[model samples]
Target: MALIPKETELQEGLTTIFEDLLLKKEGVKKELIRTRKDFNIACDQHIKSGFQSEQDWVNANASHQNKFIEYEMYCHIIDIITDFKDIHGQFPEYMEMHRTLSQIMIKLAQDEKYELAAIAKLWVDRIESTIQEHSYC
Candidate 1:
């Protein structure tokens, strides 16, 4: 029988995306489990803080021209997820999270929160492609 995989790979990918622009300058991956309201509150706070802590306020504010979060980070974040399974072995739990994340992205996009969804889309697409590629392996 083929071995089912663990979630370590998927978990790592999701964590990287969370840290980029969650409205909270500092947060953990598990925070994603919170309600949408809580997630946005955190994202708003992080964006308002200018993506850095108070200690580096001046430099950070000046370095970033975007007053609101943008989808640019999605590119790099997606790239990392694409390499995830390779770094952490494949597992069934990993697949489920990939699917769930895609669903979350859809909801976020429908709500017009495209910045984060843009990243999710790439991750989801990558996951689908990977699943297909490995289906017969």
Candidate 2:
């Protein structure tokens, strides 16, 4: 017979995972803010000078795009966490979160955002490994 983890153990594990995710979310948010500011500054400078160097525009645009994607990804994560909490009154099961992450990974890949997709894949792998570690079979 497989030994099941106690409710408290599961809760503790979930708490740790949630905390880590939240921390990452905060970091993403900070980067989003900074990138937004940089993008705006770049635009303002272009408008004021009536010209922007090609390299400067490219750098600012790339940073804006990357941070926007990251912000969207973090928003999805927040939505998943919120919905799970609202429905279950607790942190989500690892597999449940994995399912959502898998969908995100596929969507990102479809969008040709391979780097973001890879990050999502890493999250999926981490959750699966957590599930495996907790399983007793």
Candidate 3:
């Protein structure tokens, strides 16, 4: 006999999604902290007041590119995170699903059809909830 649908499965999936989001939130917070520390270190090493050491090099005829490279690097990182947020619609479930879809594919290949179907339905529900949650965005 086929397994009948269960609301419990979606509830479990949502619980898992919530935990994953909390973990991701912590990770992003840690990354921000690390970036701030690195910025402070760079400021101490290269910046004198409002001017950078590289400007001194320029004054002395040194051929350094200055903080142009550093500026570009920061922009690159911001672009990457911005792109991630844009594509994921600010929902951690999008990232959670991205990470899990490969495993879901593998399970489907192994003939775990019921499990795959349940997960797909769970994902759809999560997506709907996310749309509703972020309707103002």
Q: Ten residues in a row with the worst lDDT in model 1? A: 24-33
Shift in Å, residue 5, candidate 3:
5.6
lDDT of 1 by residue, 102-136 (tens): 77788888999786777567667766665554454
lDDT of 3 by residue, 1-137 (tens): 97633433433444555555445445655555555555555556565555656544343332122233333333433333334343423433444554454454455547755544453444445545744453434
Query: What's the lDDT for residue 30 in model 3?
Result: 59
Alpha carbon deviation, residue 132, candidate 2 (Å) = 0.8
| Each model's backbone clash number | 9, 0, 0
lDDT of each: 0.51, 0.73, 0.45
Candidate maximizing TM-score: 2
lDDT of 2 by residue, 17-130 (tens): 667777888898898888878887887787777785556766888998888888777767667756666365565565676788788889989999898888677667766666
TM-score quality measure for candidate 3? 0.36
Tell me the TM-score of each prediction against the true structure: 0.39, 0.76, 0.36
Candidate number that wins on TM-score, 2 or 3: 2
What ranking emerges by TM-score with the best candidate at the front? 2, 1, 3
